[model samples]
Target: MKAAVLRAVGAPLTVEEVDLSGPGPNEVLIRVVASGVCHSDLHVMEGVLPYPLPTVLGHEAAGVVEDVGPGVSALRRGAHVVVAVVPSCGRCRLCLRGRPNLCTAIRGRPGVMADGTRRLRLPGGEEVNHFTMISSFAQFAVVHEAAAVPVREDIPLERACLLGCGLLTGWGAAVNRARVAPGSSCVVLGCGGVGLGIVQGCAVRQAEPIVAVDLWPQRLEVAARLGATHTLLAGQEDVPALVRQLTGGGADYVFDAVGSPQTAALALSCLGRGGTAVLVGVGQRDASLSVPITATVLNERAVLGCDYGSAWPQRDIALLADMYAAGRLKLDELVDRTYPLEGVNEALADLKEGRALRPVILPWGDS
Candidate 1:
């Protein structure tokens, strides 16, 4: 199979033929139909997040099952599925508590399967690391069965790919994590793919005065089309003051979708008394944010960190698929562009330059 492998940090990914092993017990082999080029992948390429070298770096994907290993009764061949970055072991404490997004069994582990074995290898016999245990950048992936959530077949795999990570995280952050109530004023920091999804989720919740913030005008325009009631240019305006003025004393909820210390701080600054600040982006490990303890205590503000929108893949993906199928959710509009496997680097470049939103990688090459 062909895959984009990152052999060095701060370098472009190399697309080349690689070897994949068959599914192990409780694993599924998928013919990856579409994969989304996410900011997380770019972070890995730019060394913002460190990982093992020679690894395939893609986590958002939708595909069809080709084979399933022993003990995998939940899925079968021909089943359409989305690959989840976090694999929830059902027996784990978090999974049992219905918080599978923070599965303790796989958090911060190396990019390997449950048995701690590499399923990908180079022609020279060196093992290629897996990213998030899915490695959706490749033509095929052998992922844990729990990481693959079966979805309705009617939804196109290309658009469904967004549900794997960006859409799920953003949508779930607003709907589940923040629980933005109707008529509540909500502000979403960053107007990328995830930010737009957050806007849409707020729209679905009937949140009033949805504010979208970004440095790019093009993205702000798209956010308006999606659901932003107001758009703010990041560096050009007094964002916190404007938000507080517009919402009659800060927004009820603010989400930092960009995942930087600066954006997180800004999100916190835009919240009203008793309001919650949700951190939705994943920043570098070494990056830290300074919060005002006195203000937080006085204002009774809460700062919350969200992982994958605190979504349970099996339940949330199916619900999202239903919404998309019924036209209640906007999946088609979220896709800004599509690229083939060989064009993965170009897709990443477009995303890094803020020229595209949710570029899907068609592993089968526009077929």
Candidate 2:
């Protein structure tokens, strides 16, 4: 099989013919169909988030099951599935507590399988690590059965792939983590792909006066089309004051999808009394947040940290698929462009330049 190889930090990925091993116990082999270029992948490629080198870089993907290993009874060959980055062990403390998103099954091992072994290798027999359980950048991926959530066959893999990462993170933060009440005021910071999903999620909950703030006017425009009642340009507007004005005092929920210290602070500033600030983006590796204790105490404001939208992959991804099937979710609009496997680098470039919202890569397609 051919896979994209990241030899070192800050290196350009090269497509190389590699050897992929069959699935082991509790694992499954999936033929890659559609994968997305995520900011996290860029972070890993740029050395912001440290990981093993000579690895395949991709986590968000959807594909068809080619085969399944022992202990996997829930899935079989020909089943369409979406790959999840947070594959839970199901028996861990977090998983048992209904917080599978925070499962500690692979704390110290982000690059390999649970048993500390890789399933990919080069022609010369050198090991190539997997990124986030399933490296969907390749022609095929071997992942734990739990990581592969079965989706409806009608929804295209290209659209369903977004549920694995960006969209899920933003949408889940609203519906899962914050649980914004209907008619409540909400403000979303950083109108990227995730922020756009947050806006849509707020809309789904019927939250009023959805305020979206961003540096890009184009994204703000997209947010308006999705569900934002108000949009503010970051550098040109007094965002917090405008949010306060739009929401009648402050928003009930403020989501920081940009994940910077600055944006996180802005999220806190946009909240009203008893409001919560949800941190959704992973900005910097060494980023530390400082909050005003006196103000928070006086206003009774709260801050919440979210990972993967606080999602249970099996439940939430399936719900998203159903929503899309019912024409209630905005999956098709999220796709800004598509690329073949060979154009993965160009796709990454587009992501960095903000040229596309969600670029899907077809591993088997030709340009």
Candidate 3:
């Protein structure tokens, strides 16, 4: 199978004829229809988040089941599915307690299955590493059955790919993690793909006075089109003050989707008393968030970290699919460009330009 493999850090991914393994017990082999080029994948490629070399680097994807493993009963051949990066061991404590996102089985590092073994290989007998436990860059991916959530047949594969990551991360941040109630106010920092989804989620919740802040005017414009009631372009002015002014003296919830310390501080400052600040971006490894100790205690402000929008794949994927089916989620507009696996660099270049919202990768043939 042909895949975009990262041979070295800070280097371009090369298209190579890599060897892929067939499904093992409880695993499913998927013919990847489309994969989203995510910022997290860029981070992996840039060595911001360190991973083993010669790895296939896509995580946000949707495909059809080509084959099922011996013990996998939840999925069938030709079933459409979205790949979830976080795998939940169903019998684990966290999974049993209804928090599958925090399932401890695969916590802290990249490993596959209960035995901590990888499934990918190279043509010359070398083992290839998987990224984010999904590795959807390849034409065929062998993933645990739990990681593949079955979706409806009608949803477009490219749009469904967004639901695997950006959509789930942003929508879950607003609806589930932040719990933005109706009539509440929200300030979303960064109007990129995930930020726009957050804005839409707030709108779907009937949250009033949505404020979106971004340095890019185009993104801010898209934010307004999606759901934001107000847009603030970050120029020389203070963002927190603008958020406060727009929300009538402070927002009930402020989300930092940019993930830098500066944006985190802005989100913290824009919050009203007893308000929550959600950090949705993955910050740099060495960066530290400095918060005023006195102010946090005095105002009763809560700072939260959201991982994959705090979503349970089974429940949230279905809900997002339903929302997409109902025309509530903006999956179609979120797609900026589509590229084949060979055009990975072009897709990524467009992603860094700040013009395109989200770029998807379409694998060729084999389905």
Q: Model 3: per-residue lDDT, tens digit, 249-361? A: 78899988889888888888898888899999885877778888888899888999998888899899988898899987888888877888888988877777785789889
CA lDDT, every model vs. true structure: 0.90, 0.90, 0.86
The true-structure Cα RMSD of candidate 2 reads 1.3
Clashing pairs in 3: none
RMSD per model, one decimal? 1.2, 1.3, 1.7
Clashes of 2: 0
TM-score of each: 0.98, 0.97, 0.96
Pairwise lDDT winner, candidates 1 and 3: 1
| Candidate 1 residue pairs that clash | none
List clash counts for every candidate, in order.
0, 0, 0
Per-residue lDDT tens digits of candidate 1, residues 1-367?
A: 9999999998889999999997988899999999998999999899888888889988899999999998899998999999888778778888898899988685436767778889999999999998978898889999988889999999899999998899989999999899889999999999887898899999999999999999999999889988889999999999999999889999999999988889998998899998899999887887778989999999999999899989998889899999999998898877878999999999999999998888899988888
Error of 3 at 246 (Å): 1.1
